[model samples]
Target: MLKIGSGAGFSGDRLEPAEVLLEHAELDYLVLECLAERTIALAQKEKFHEPEKGFDPHLEVRVRRLLPLLSNQKTRLITNMGAANPEAAATKIVEIAKELNISCKVAAVTGDDVFQVIETNHLLPNDNPQQVKKENLLSANVYLGAEALLPALETEADIIVTGRAADPSLFLAPQIHHFQWSMHDYEKLGKGTVVGHLLECGAQVSGGYFADPGKKEAADLADIGFPFAEIEEDEVVIKKVEGTGGVINLQTVKEQLLYEVHDPANYFTPDVTADFSKVEVKETGENQVQVTGGKGHERPDKLKVSIGYHAGFIGEGEISYAGANAEARAALAGSILEKRLSDKVPHLRIDYIGMSSLHRTSFGEHTPYEVRVRAAGHSDSEEVAALIGKETEALYTNGPAGGGGARKKITESIGVLSNYLSRDQVHPKLIIRSTDNETI
Candidate 1:
């Protein structure tokens, strides 16, 4: 059995749970997924100023902490921690390996950047041939598939870093090289992709974020354990560290299976088209569930590209009101802020945060002892954005009684626009710059 573990569900996940796996779990490969829909855009924004600052902020910490545990284990590390720059990340990993006096080869996979095509001809060649504009475009990256990572696996590299790879592709790549699974075998590849998808979110399927008060109870949630997939003869058993917190059941697994799925029958990827409509899942043991019945078709001809741009700014302010008629005071404060700053901004919004904030359409009933009135705006001008927060802060001194905890700020945001291009458009390759510089 080739055991693979999920070290992280997202970019800012808990570090301790992964550390526990590095210390105790017996595994072949440990995959860490830390990218999201707009995470790459945010990374691109950072890279705009400082060239080597776009990768995950926690890359060094994750690698440095896991080095000691790698001394006696066979688990090799795989992660898309290389957010915007894989070469820079690989350099940092080489430095860390030298610092710890550990000998390991690190490989970086690149060529996800589509700006190469846009910059030369100012237009794409396949499908979307519209003139590519360099005006507000921050980052243009093609979603590389599992096959793009095959060259790295064939090498003796201990650590593999990638940029802009599909979420499930990160987990499926290792299985292909280790199990000798054919890239054209859609059935096995599809089931493998399903296992990758189920385990991709780490604790999402292991009950970290699936617990309810009285309906579903998960024990030791405060110290929830990271999950792992045990694969043997084309079957997968999802389990977590023994004696750790969190529960894994049929419901938890089922919820995660359909978490981000738009359509099960036509789920498209560069590797294969997976169909999860009839995937059979059942609990086989404690914290262990068997999954099968995932079907697949031919690979897609095009790959999705995420194009990021600078989207204006958002300014927000929040203040609390407590005691008698708190809800009325909150309502009154919202009205006052709107009356003052209504015509000043483009997209001004007012809400009683504690009441009708979550579901904007639903006006909540039964007010409590306190409610927070929040006013916000989105604008291309920072001055206009800042006005929304400034007016709301005025309520602390000029409006409502017993209003406290006034807070205001402006946040820079990134906007993402995705489009599809042919698979031939993207050119992925492995850059072997392993740490051969031994300076202990």
Candidate 2:
């Protein structure tokens, strides 16, 4: 059996859980699925400003902390923390290894950045052509598959860093590399993809996102553990480190299995069109769940591309009201800001935090002891966006008797859209660098 563990789920996930996995799990591979839709776009922006700093902001911290633990161990690391610049990320890792005197090989898988291939006149998936201007485009990255990672793995690199690789493909690559599974074996590929999907989100399947206080209580969630999978040709079992906080029973497994899956019968990925419709999960032992029956067909002809563009600026302001008639005061404050800024910021939104913020519809007549009034809007002009928070903060002395704790913020928003490119157009290349060698 091959054991693989997840070091992180998202860009800013806790680092301690990954440390636990490295210290105890004795994993054969550790995959960190960091990189999200807007994350790469933000990284691209950073790269535009500073060429050498487009990778994950926490790359140095993670590599500095985890590299030593992986030095003598057989465990290899794979991660998409490379974001907009995998080559730079690989170089940084090599530098960190040299600083710590640890000998290791690092491979960077590139060619996901397909900005040059995209045309300004190209149409988006469901939208019209050329809706986004070329000047406003931030980044365009193709989602690469398991095949792209194969060469990197074959290089015997201790660490493989990639840009915009499909989430499941990261886990499936290791399976294919170790087991020598045929690329055409759809059934096994689907099963391996299932394992990847389950363990990709780190602690989600092990009870981090599955927790509900009274309805579904997980043990010692404050110190939740990341998940790992033990896989063979015919079997897959999900488990976590012993004595670790969290549960990994059938319930958690079931929830995670369908986490972002839109269609059970046809989940489109860069690697394969996985079929999780017949997949089953059974709790065979404590903190262990056996998964089976996942299948797949041929992969898609066109790979999905995530395109990021400048989406203007967003400004928001919030003020709290407590005690009697708090809801009424908060509502009044929201109305005042709406009327004040509606002319300048046409697309304004006012919400009462304890009341109609989430659903946008009123709940009932029941009043809460505290309510927060928030005014937010998006505008092409930074000055217009700034007015939203400025007007809302004026409520402190302007009215609404108990108003307090006023806060405001303005941020440049990055909008993400989708497009498709022919799979043949994306050619992933591997560049291997080691602490022992100067050239890649």
Best by lDDT: 2
Candidate 2 residue spans exceeding 4 A from truth: 120-130
Best by TM-score: 2
lDDT of 1 by residue, 164-227 (tens): 9988898889999888989999987788889889988989988888899799989989989999
- Residue pairs in steric clash, candidate 1? none
How good is model 2 by TM-score? 0.97
| Global lDDT of each candidate | 0.83, 0.90
| Error at 282, model 1, angstroms | 1.4
lDDT of 2 by residue, 2-24 (tens): 99999999989999988888899
- The window of 10 residues in a row where model 1 has the poorest summed lDDT is 124-133
The true-versus-predicted C-alpha distance at residue 233 of model 1, in Å, is: 2.7
Q: Each prediction's TM-score against the native?
A: 0.94, 0.97
